[model samples]
Structure formats: C-alpha cells, structure tokens
Target chain A: MIPVTVLTGFLGSGKTTLLARLLKSPEFARTAVIINEFGAVGIDHDLVEAGEESFVQLETGCLCCTIRGDLEATMADLVARRADGVVPPFERIVIETSGLADPAPILNAIMSEGARGSGLALGGIVTTVDAVTGLATLAREAQSVRQAAVADRLILTKSDLAGEAADLRVRLAALNPRAPLSEALFGEIDAGVLLYTEYDRLDDFHTHTHHVHADDIQCIAIRRSEPMRALTLTLLLEALADHCGAGLLRLKGIINVAEYPHRPAIIHGVQHIFHAPAWLEGWSTADHDTRLVLIGRGLSEAWVLNLIAAIEAEIAEIAPQQAPAPL
Target chain B: MDEALLALITSSLALWERAGDVRREAGGAIALESEGHEVRITRAAPDVPFRWSITIDGRARVASSVPGLLRVLRAGLDPDFRPSRVRIAPIGITPS
Candidate 1:
C-alpha cells in the first residue's frame, strides 16, 4: 500500500519552510506532494519548491469540508493516470494541509477514502507547532489544539527564536501525552521519525492512540468477536455518516468480512466521507475478530452499539435468506 | 457507477446552489431544471460507447465517462465554473 503522510499546523507555523527543506531530502525524493490552500487563489504552491510535476495543488476549500470528494477523486485520478502513464509515477504521497485544517478528517480521508484496492496506506500525522507563539496559538485557536492532539509526531518550529518552552511543553503533554515531540530548528528534522514504517509499534502503540481526557476527543475501541456481513459494515458507516456528522472524527480498523474471511478489509472514514474499503491479502492480527478504533467528539459507545445491532436486525429481517455481496 | 454519477451531479448541484434543481426522473434517469432550461441525463444505449447523453437547450451532447458528462453539464449550465488546472510536480530524484 502507498503511504500518505499529512503535514498540518496553524497559519505561519513554518510548514512551508519545513516542506522546502523536506523536498530536498533524499527520502522525500519521488514523493507526490499535495499542497492544499483554503482560498480561491492558491499561493502556497508558488511559495514552496517541490518536484515540478509531483506537487498536486488542491484548493478544495478545506481538507475537512464538503470538497473532500475532490480530494478523493484527485487521488483516484492521480493513481489512474499514473497507471495509464498520464502522470508521473511517485513512490509516496504527502499532503500539506492549510493552517486552519482539522487534521482528523484529512487523515481520515487519506486512510479511508482511498479505499480498497487503492493501494494507499495512512503514513503518519506530523504537526508543526510554532514554538515562538505555539502556546498562545494553542490556547487561542481550537483548530491548532486539535491538529496537535491528533498528530503522531509534533515538530516545534522556530525553536531557535524562542526561549523557555516549559509551559508550552506542559500544555502540549496535557493535551496529547502520546505524540513524540521535537523541535524543527533550521527547518530540519530527522526524516525517519516523521516518515517511519512499522506504524504498529507495540511498545508505543498507546502513545499514538487517541487518549486525550482534557479535550473531548477520545478513542472508542469497537471489538467484534463474530464475523460481520460486509453489508452490515456498509450500513453501519452510512448510519454513522447520517447521524454522527462532525461528532465522528476518524474511524480506522481491520474488519473481518464474513464473505472474505481470508482477506481482511481495512475500513477508514473522516466525518461522512468513507473511503472505499481496502481488502488486505491476509489477516495481520493473530486473533482475527473485527477491531475498530473511533476517535471522535462525544462519541457514545452504547449508542453506536445499539445502532449497529438495530441495523443488522433490520437487514436480517428484511433479507433473511441472503446476505448482500461483500462490499 | 450509478452512485458515482449521482454523487458527481449532486455535488455539482450543491455547488450551483439554487441555480438549478436536480431530480430523479422515471426509468433511472436524472433531470436538471433551471429557469427556462432543462437538461435530461439518461444512460446511453449499451451498444453506444458513451455513458451519458446530456440534453440542454434541445441539443444533446454525448460524454464517454462521468467526468466527461460533468464537463459537458457545467459548460451548458454554470458560467462561473472553471476547472482548476491540476499540476503534478515532474519526476525528480529517486530514493535509493
């Protein structure tokens, strides 16, 4: 699967500076960069220098908004065109989101929307925090707080210009004690830490998992022992999309579709936009049953359980004879 | 395919916002009605290579795919819609 990394921070968080430096790295070479701007006229593309034909500029409102469809289609088109020799063949994709972006949905889109058979895997979330004003920005802007909250790695930019960050570090740790924090001085960070493989590290798995109590964002782990009909999963996502809305931030997990038991399906979604379900070759986990982690705002585990049961029951009564084909 | 086509149309109508109304017609066809113009979209014949025939101002335009039909509909309907020119950075240094 192709790894897609998301780079997000507040305005003037020095994302561009870090991106400029990153583009020059040997690891980032052959990377397809997507620069997303919030306005009508995009200027971020012009500000940074990447591979001339590898950077895709997405001025689709915001990454978390209605224009998420654009993001999926763009990636799909890129993949399709690349296969047809219409676009350049890049090894990986990197999305640089607008400063005000909510990284959860954007990450969800990448993880989910690329879908089954899209050959895309969620890499990691790297949030650039402005060391000079990051403390005040985190306190003032809720978006910045969320961006930092969901990141796997937090890079404090402009650290050279700042002093005494004990308070900021404390606040960050309080908000997100899991994300490994570092400073991006001279617009440089060790590439391996940001774009690392083996995302499923057992030792630090809890660190990357969403577990913020200070913030409303918390993760709900949904574990099912029995194999689920693929249709049930689709209906569940649809029901959640209709009911949850913004309350549902990100959903990710491996599902054991009843029909395709050998190949587990990877499910992902950001808000209402659910990516096409990707089917893996085989079960990665030793103990198979479905396992899903939902990080959201005010997510009721009981309500979700009831909804799934209700939908499954309704489907069973309506079409008891036959289970719909695996999605 | 039908869902994708409908989504594209639905999203475009949302973008248009009150400029035109899109509704499902009988026999799995879609009809978009604006002030005086009505564009009927129906799946083309199986033998035909095109996917859809978008009828606007009593003229029909054939589009081979979903995106093609979208372009045709936009050209016929919305004046403000300008497709963003997507630029993919050229291939550069490869990683070892």
Candidate 2:
C-alpha cells in the first residue's frame, strides 16, 4: 500500500516550504507529490521538481467544493500512470492542500469506494500553523480551526520569528489535544517524525508500536498475536463505533485471524464510520502479530484493554455454538 | 409561513439557538428558490445521487449531501464564504 500523507494549512502557513525540504530528504526520495494551489496561476507547481507531469495543479476556483470528483479522477489517473511506468517510480505520495481548502473531503475521496482498489491509503494529516499569527487566524477563520482540529500532527511554522512559541502551542493544544505539535525553523524539520511512518514493520511474537504523545490525549497501540475470531473483532468495532464515534480520530491495524491465516485483514476507521475491512494477499511483512493504533481525545488505555478482553471472551463463548452441525 | 415552513422555522430557530446563533426567520427560503430568494429542501428519490433540492430564484440546484446543501446555503447567506481555488505554493518559513 502506498502511504498518502496530506499536508494542509491556512493561507501562508508555510506548507510548501516544508514540503520542499521534506522532498530533499532521502526518506522522501521516491515520493510523488500533488500540490493544490488557490489560483489560476500555478507558482507552487513550478517550484517543486519531482518528475515531469508529476506536479498536478487544481485550478478550479474552489477545490473543496467543486473539485472532489476531479481530485478522485486525478488520483486514479496517477495510479494508472504509475502502474504503466509512465511516471517516475514512487514509494509514497504526498498531497498539499491549498491554504483555504478543507482537508476532510479530500480524505473522504481517498477512502471512498472507487479509490480504495487503486492501492492508495491515507497515511496521516499534517497541518501547518503560522507561529506568529496562527492563534489569531484560527480564531477568525473557521476553516483554519477545523484544519487544526483534525490534524494528526501540527507543524508550527515560523517559530524562529516569534518572541515565544508557547502561546501558539497552548492554543493548538486546546483545539486538538491529540495531535503532536512540532516546531519548524525555516521550513526545516526532522522528516522521520513529521512524516507518517510511525509503525511500518511488525513482529508477531512481540509488539511493535509508536506512542503518539498528545497534550491531554494519548494514542494507544494494542498488539496481540493470538488468532482473533472474526466475530470478536466485529463486536469490538461495533462497540467502539457506537460509544466513542466523535472522539475517535482514526484507527489503523493489520489483524491476524483464526479463520483466515493466509490473508491478514487491514482495518481502518474514522469516527463512527468504519471502512470495509480489506484482506491483503499476503502480510505486509513476516511478523504475524496484530497491531492496532487508536488516536482519540482523552482515551483511556485501561478501558480499551478491558474492552478487548471482554470482547474476546464473548467470542470464545459464542464460538462453540457457532461450530457447524455434524456433516 | 406554511405549516411545514413554520415548523421548519421553529426547529431551525431552536437549532440555531442551541448552536448559539442569535436569530432565524421563516420569511423565505435561504437558498435556491424559483420565485424569489427562497429555496425548498425536501427528500429526493432514494435512487438519486442528491437528496435535497435548493431552488434559487426559481432555479433548482440539487445537492448530494447535507454538507453540500450547507455549502450552497452558506454561499447564499454569507457573501464572504467564497470557495477559492487551490494553488501550489512551497511550504515556507514564516515569522513565528
């Protein structure tokens, strides 16, 4: 699966500078970038050099409103072109949204029906906030507030110019307590932490996880290798969806199941809506363990652990009855 | 206001009040309308992609989802809610 990272910010939050720096890193060497600018004239497209025709500009007046279909088609075309070797090889994809654009629709398009089979999956949402004026802009612009609210990572650009970054950090924490806030100097940041590669590899016997540190929120990773019954996973997901839909930001994992050993299931969820579980032809890697990362507001790790145990126990009880009648 | 229109006004008033808005009225439709600036929003056939119709000065525009409907309504209600095109710009170094 190609991990697609979404970069967004309010007008002039320094998203492009950050992208330019990130692309130079060896980690992003094989990455394909799609930048959306908010004008008929496309200067951002000219600034970045990735591959010929790889830089796409969405000149539609309002991308968030009028260009969702266009965005979907563009992604499809990119996938098709890549498969046909028409474009340079890329291991990852990054999408930079215009300053005034809403990131949610773009996210929905990626997770929607026709796009899933194209081998593109959402990596994470990174929002850039101008350190000097971020707080004021967020106060005035509802779109900016929502952008900060839904971010997986918050990048504070122009931190060096500020007398103090503390006030802006405090404001961001209040808006999105679950996202990690990082300071950027001259658009330069450590790509490893900024990019979404938190948990790339897996080990079945042992748990491999990343603990996302948030202000009052915590992202908990639950790793289990024991083969889980299908019904157990269903029950757990149902409970989560029903009880904590709004607070739940995102969930991503690969599950090892008793019924399907050869094919591990890829599961992801945003709020109450859970995407249809996808079964991979083979494990992304040899480690057969189940890794579940849950990002939410004020999540209680103990509660989640108990909930999983309870669901598994219920499944254990139901499995005996679910056994097939004698042939 | 018609009965349904009055009720819609009442409910919207309640909703607006609950959401901390100051005032709402049932004088006319706020979005797409054929005769005037009033628009009618009702459920569309299940098979249709859009579930709502917004008529602006007798011109009806269908919307697929609530968000889409709201977008139209907002554009009509607030002139500043312009949907600007997206452009490509380098993520820059800004003053903190």
Candidate 3:
C-alpha cells in the first residue's frame, strides 16, 4: 500500500518551507507531492522544488470543500499514470492541504474505498504550528486548534525567531496527548520522523481526562470492555452523525466486534463520512478493549455513554424476535 | 427506556446548539418544543413492526426505530437540521 502523508497547518505556518526543504533531501527524492491552495492562483507549488512528473498543484479550491471529489480522481489518475509508465514511480505521496482547510474531510477522501482500491493508505498527519504566533493563532482561529488536535506529529516552525512557548506546548499537549511534539528551525527537520509515524492507540484515556478548549472544541475518549455487535456499532455511528452533525468533528476507534473476536476493526470517521472498518489480523496486545477518541465541539460525555447504552438495550430487546427459527 | 429517550433528546438539542425544552409527559410520552415547533414521541403498539409513534404538529408518523424517531423530531424542531447521511465506503476491490 502506498502511504499518503497529510501536511497541514494554519495560514503562514511554514508548510511550504518545510515541504520545499523535505523535497531537497535524499529521503523525499522519490515522493509524489500534492499541494492544495485556495483562490485562483497558488504560489506554494512554485516554492517547492521537485520533478514535474510527480508534482501536482490544486489551485481550484480547498481540498476539504469544493475539490474533495477532485482529490480522489487526482490520486487515481496519478496512480494510473505511474502504472502506465507515464510518470515517475513514486513510492509515497504527500498532500499539503490549504492553510484554512479542515484535515478531516481530506482524510476521509484519502481513506475512501476508491483511493484504497487504487492502493493508497493513510500514512500519518503532520501539522505545523508557528512558534512566533502559534499561541495567538490557536486562540483566535478554531481551524488552527483543529489542525493541531488531529495531528500525529506537531512541528513548531520558526522556533529560532520566538521565545519558548511553554503555554502553547501545554495547551497542545492537553488537546492531544498522544502526538509527539518537535521543533523545526527554518522548516528543517528529519523527514523520516515526519512521514513514517503511526496512529497511536488511545490507551491513556483511563488516566487522562477529557479536555475542552475555549472554542468549545472538546477531546473525548470512550473505552468499552465488552465487544459490540457489528449492527450495534453501525447504529451508534449513524445516530451520532444524525444528531451531532458538524458538532462531530472527528471520531476514530479500534473496535472489538463480537462476531470477529480475534480480528479487530479499525474505524475512522470525519463528520458524516465514515470509512468502512478495516479488519486487523490480531490484537497487538493482550488487552482487547475497544478504544475510541472523539474530538468535537460541545459534545457531552454522559450523553454519548447514554446513547450507546440505549442503542444496545434496544437492539438486545429486538434481536430475539428477529432471530431466525430452526426448521 | 423513556428516561433514556428523554436524556437523548435533551442532549440532541444541546448538540444542535438550539434552545428547546424536552420533558416526559404522563403515559410515558416525551414532548419537545423548540422555536414554535412541537414534537411528542410515544411507544407504538407491540403488534406493529414500528417501535415509536412520533407526532409533529398534530400529524402522527410511525417510526421503525429510535434513529427514525430522532430524524422526525429533528425535522420538526430545527429548520436547518439536515441529516448527514452516513456513507460507508465499500471494502475490497470493485471492477475498475
């Protein structure tokens, strides 16, 4: 599977600076790049130096909104061209989303069935935070907070120009405790570390409490010891999307399906778009508890727990009558 | 079950960021009023496949499940409440 890394940040967070530097490195020489910029003209692509065969610039609109459909088509075309020997055979892809774009929808597009069938897998997400104005941006922009909250690796860019942002680090850590924090001076950092990270299983929620930000964006973790039926899980997701709407920003979980006790299902969702559960070979550890992390705006913990309970109870009550009888 | 439904309705309203009132009426019915829209939900007869009877503006509709009931309630209460349909990407390869 070809891994796709999403590099995102707020406006003027030095994403292009970082990408340009990475493309010059030996590590990112064989990588394909997709740069998305809002408005009629995009300048970020011109800043990045790479071979023309494997580089694409989306200047139509933001990848998360109007051009979401175009993203899948673009990747598919790129894959086809590579297979046909039309373009260079790049082993990986890096999509640099627009500064104001929401990463969740872009993620959903990458994890869609069409992209997966074309041999694309989600590598990881790297979000850049400006060290000089990171605190003020996080305070003023909800998009900035979301970009940091969903990242697997957080890079503080332009660190040489600013003093130590201890408060910003604390705030980011509170919002996302699992992501490792790194500092980049002039967008220079280790490319391997940024591109080759895995999504960490949310196992620390037992000790860490749910965090709510000033903009009403919240990080909620749900853990279930009992395995859920596949149907129950489906209903739960549907209910959440129907009721929460945009309030449900992102939801990802490693679920323990009752029918498949050995193979766990990995589920990822953004707003209403949910990827079909990908079954894993086996549990990584002895613990088989289902772990879910939900980042949203104004979501109540008790209400979510109650919603799950109510759905399970209702399903159990009707399952017996709906079960097929022996001949 | 009524208590659970009441809580769910209350939370649903909060999630939508709309001001409303959800309360349990006598005879195990849950009533909700928001922005001049009124909705009442009650358990349906056991003989029918439908599980709940949702009444909106005096027009009663039978809902097959709790999700269906919530959909109706949202339609009545919030004018801007457009249900985001869940699309499950098909797994495995399809004919290219």
Tell me the RMSD of model 3 versus the true structure.
4.1
What is the C-alpha DockQ of each candidate?
Answer: 0.02, 0.02, 0.36
TM-score of 2: 0.59
RMSD of each: 13.6, 14.4, 4.1
Q: Rank candidates by lDDT, best first.
A: 3, 1, 2
Which numbered prediction scores highest in DockQ against the true structure?
A: 3
For candidate 3, write residues B17-82 as lDDT tens digits. 778898998778888888777888888999998998989889888887667777878777777779
Q: Sort the candidates on TM-score, descending order.
A: 3, 1, 2
Docking class of 3: acceptable
Per-residue alpha-carbon lDDT of candidate 3 for residues A87-175, written as tens digits (9 for 90 to 100): 78998899999999989789888889899889987878899999989999998988898899888789999988887888888888887
**Per-prediction TM-score of chain B?**
0.73, 0.45, 0.80
**Candidate of highest lDDT:** 3
TM-score of each: 0.60, 0.59, 0.85
Write out the backbone clash pairs for model 3: none
Model 1 Cα lDDT, one tens digit per residue, A57-90: 5554777775566777767776787789876787
Q: Rate the local accuracy (lDDT) of all candidates.
A: 0.69, 0.64, 0.79
Task: Please give the lDDT score at residue B7 for candidate 2.
Answer: 36
- Tell me the TM-score of model 1: 0.60
In candidate 2, the second chain superimposes onto the true chain B with a TM-score of: 0.45
Error of 2 at B25 (Å): 49
